[model samples]
Target: MISSCFVTAIQVLILFTLSSPCVRASTFTGSMFEVQISTKLPVKDWVKEAKKDSDPFSLWDPTCFKFVSAIKSVDNQLKEALYTCHSVPGGDENTRLKIYLFIPPERLAPEKQEPCLRAAYKKAFDDWKAGVSANFQIRPEQVQFSCELSV
Candidate 1:
């Protein structure tokens, strides 16, 4: 017994409530280094647990330590590296992973740090494979790195 106008109004309200999170505008301040990983492993969950979680420092284990250590060793003055990761959608593999490394300005510049960053990621990959089971292994070529300025 509801009128069409009432049904339309309710639908609009429901749509707005569901889409509000995506409608908000936010800015990222810092440099963003992307680590693109293509693998069959459950990288999405691993990244969510290791980097995207609120208390990653507490959740991280030796693999995280080795990864961060390798990144820090890229430069003596390098101090900050914040991470956020997500799985790329509609990929051919089990998952295509993107790890965002955010660092403040006047610290690490993308152009100057890319090569070292690649090496660091390679080392991290090796450490990760060594620590995990055979099923979780990823090859060196499966990981790629790129850097960009945060807008």
Candidate 2:
């Protein structure tokens, strides 16, 4: 139990460190909308093909916001994901799930970024588990992912 707790602490620290920039960046902010793919693709093929396509994510996307980063969750049978495709809005050009965030600059709250991010992360894991219970298989570029602010 102690070991598990220690590992959890370490994981939290690492996540906090990596996510701090996204939560603190001044130029952009938005939630990382994750979507799960129903089919499994070879790892290399999946990564190579994800950013090259432009199918829009209509169901999972919250149209009220725009994001700055986009990412895809990796597939592993032992683990499930919460959301697939991490994306950053208002940044450069990255082939995305088609849904965009439209948040206003004036309403930005760099410090309060954790709640949304944490919520997104939690949802991603939940989605992963739900997939299995629902008989949904994982797919390439369709795994869980998150988007943080670009530094």
Candidate 3:
């Protein structure tokens, strides 16, 4: 029979080995902008409702060629946005949907170029909110933007 102390030591070793990758992964950092959407409905349902609308860019200011060109320029500069959703703690009957826009270190835009991208993102988000508000039971005011940059 295995001794209790031996079993405990083996468990500890397994745990340490299993956790090493997580520790190493945390050490690697990058630049990202996060947009959080707070809603009363399930996140998947909310997103589906939101996506039902036509593309925001196509609807927002199609008459202005300059604006469309600017948005396309901004889009070309950034990476694809990643989305994640989860339930809020404490049984609040709310969901938190996070959108992550990852900017590679080499592709990071200068300070002067940020406002254009931010405005485009904000408008797109606003359009989405307006389109999905009725179906998702969320208001435009509940979205929040946070930025994290690793220099």
Ranking of predictions according to TM-score: 1, 3, 2
Top lDDT model: 1
**What is candidate 2's CA lDDT for residue 87?**
28
User: Residue-wise lDDT of candidate 3 within 2-65, one digit each (tens)?
Assistant: 0100111011111112224553222122333333446444434434544554654323222222
TM-score of 1: 0.37
Assess each prediction's global lDDT (C-alpha) against the native: 0.40, 0.30, 0.35
Cα deviation of 145 in candidate 1 (Å)? 1.4
- Sort by lDDT, best first: 1, 3, 2
Q: Determine which window of 10 residues in candidate 2 has minimal summed lDDT.
A: 1-10
**Where does candidate 1 stray beyond 4 Å?**
1-28, 42-80, 105-107, 110-135, 148-151
lDDT of 1 by residue, 1-151 (tens): 0010011101111112222456543344444444444655553465556665454431443233334444444433333544534345644653443433334443343344566664664465444333322334556456555543232
**Regarding lDDT, does 2 or 3 come out ahead?**
3
Clashes of each: 0, 28, 0
User: How does candidate 1 score on lDDT?
Assistant: 0.40
